[model samples]
Target: MLEARDTVEHEIWWEIKGGTSNVWYENWTKLGALNYVVPTDYPINEELVDVSDLIEGGAWNDQLLHQSFPADIAEHIKSEIYIDQLQGNWDRPWWMLTSTGRYTVNSAWNMLRHRDHEDSDFKQLCIKGVPFKIYFLLWRVLKGRIPTDDVLMKMKIPIASKCYCCSIPQQETIQHLFLTGQFATDVWQVFKNAVGIHMNLTQMKQVRYPCLKNAPFLWNELIDFLEGYKPILVSKIVYWNLPYDGWYKCNSDGASRGNPGPSSYGFCVRNCHGDLVYTECKELGINTSMVAKAMALKKGLMYCFENDLQPLIMETDSLIMKNVVEGIWECPWSIVAEVDIIKKLKARCNVLILHVYREGNSLAYFLTNLAFYFAGTSRFNSFVDLPSAGKRIINMDKQQIPNIRIRNAKNTSGMDIFT
Candidate 1:
């Protein structure tokens, strides 16, 4: 317990209520504990009791906060942390590692595991629906515990190390069995050809087919995936839908020249009567596509807050951002800060962020593309100000005319071994 004290301290989120949590020590705010960032010589008033001292009349004591801490810390406290005013409420400690904020054995196990989960390779290697024996085999291969001739010889077995699967007289090492030998090469070739997978497998050593391990499909699964897939006539009609009366819709999008290269975000607002009201776009410098998508929604939410766009429906084409913001999926660590800010903005603005197909978000898509050519931000306040193509989309949306989205969906009718 003593050894884990420092490490587990970071996972406990102190939910401030009556705010008895220590102002300098507790992690009620995501900006981190105050003592870590505050100056050691900074003056502290002994009379100040706890976090509740900074709250007055069911709201944050802004003036006191500004006087007590730096400007940024004060802002973070106000934005990220909220308070409840129940008379006997206590600051609850929640396990931050789990989605439900409750401690679980699985979450703890995942955190304490020695394997590198950050690589997202574990799930790929342990393909679901694959037999338990296959899983055991893969695990043994990874651990170099498989009973290959080299391993058997090391175990003091009195037998010549000879290849079991082929005519070659090569020593039956793990590498030869899985990677370099002729039999392994043929198996890999069949797997690759069947799966139509193209990957650079030259750099990996002792692994015959690194790509297959990294892919979600197993070797047997590829047989069906290759012969089972055929072009089927499938069409999905994606179109912009107008918000109900007394509400507005904000469609936002993000664009990146390369995934982490010159990224940009754009948003457009439309009233129930289908009038293009406000639109804005700006480049986000160098950032990932995920960040760009999240920032776009955040900017849209901010606009809603500023314009009093209440009972608003916000839409974006980023499914990941939608699920993350809605708490349906885990938030990626890279954009945890941005997602936090977005969640607060979403709650404060009373905005419902939903995922829309890219075809339905054409106007915002146009604005996102426009940001690339411009050096700075751009804004439009009127429908008349929109370019011809933008105006055309709005007009079509006004008439409820759907923009057709046709996709060549693969026919999965040919059933085979899913396992």
Candidate 2:
């Protein structure tokens, strides 16, 4: 008998019997003989042993008796046998091995195993941050697959014992997020109002919990609630003028450098949210301050009407122009025709003309200066260079009454249309 170390440093004893001396010597030289034992094919029925049991049972069958086994020898043997069997090409789903590697039943594997088809839902889940386990849970929640506490615990989300938002001692699940949080309650209320649906808070919570899974309609309702609630919250903020949450306010102005000499006009329009809707300047040929005022009013009015807005409050730095517009003073004859037409248009809406200080109207003056710079090199008489703001106002007037014309220097040059 001969004894020596095998691959894992485990001792193997070889019994030499009935073999030629030369064969025994060759086996010994190759280290194939262990403890002077020569290799021999022992006839054993391998067919009777269940492969699964063989892998699982491990050292339960005492085939080798050279050494004593450890406390977990049986388990270690079973694990090794199972891995060997897996490598031996047993017919099973590829996912069983793949999932065993990652310890996760990824989506691709799950879809292969189950055949209920939903391409849209499947595509959505393929996005990052969606775990296979979580997606399965959501699908079950949508399909009424209420998981047991053990299954949920297996998911390994942090804070498994309580709701993350409210710290309630329960499974931190989707239902808790939607129904229990204070923010969620406010959101639900706004959502109900937006979709023209009325539901008590408690009723909404109850209905959503039980029906969310297994009901497509309920899933759609949840989607709609999420999508529509934000804009309604914004609208409420604007209507109430809440700080940092309301609509903006904008102010516009127009300026003319010299009455009837190298004139330019500027105007601005803004919303209650304080956003600049439009701002522009135009060079008008040899026009007075009154003409600039008329031009600015035209631009501002056009902007409001085109945007389908009303109840506008327009401010100008020209006190005389503001007074004339509001019927507090008479306008000059040179521009009264245009002013009268604008006043008539203004009366069609809730328009208020107020005189702002020149300091408050600086943006319009800046724009007017820009217009002068550009217009200095252009032809003065043609209306093609008129700002789009002015064009919008002119279009609005034409829409209101066909063929409305204001006589300028070409017809009744000195007549005041307001008279």
Instruction: Give the Å error, residue 256, model 1.
Output: 11
lDDT to native, each model: 0.77, 0.47
* Candidate 2: C-alpha lDDT: 0.47
List the candidates' TM-scores in order: 0.56, 0.30
For residues 1-419, could you state the per-residue lDDT of candidate 2 as single tens digits?
Answer: 12311221221111112222232222211233222332244333334223233223323344431122232443333321113112333322111123121224354345445656667965676678888898876677655456544346677734345554553455545565557665566788898888756664434644555323322346667567545632111111101111122332223444556655777776665455434456666777666666677777666665666575556767677777777777777655444434655676676765666665554454455566668778432222223444565444434332332222233332223444323
Worst 10 residues of 2 by lDDT: 232-241
TM-score of 1: 0.56
* Per-residue alpha-carbon lDDT of candidate 1 for residues 11-122, written as tens digits (9 for 90 to 100): 6677664677788776767455777767888776566668888888888889999888888788867764544353567876767776457787677656666446353544
Candidate 2, residue 186: how far the Cα is off, in Å: 96
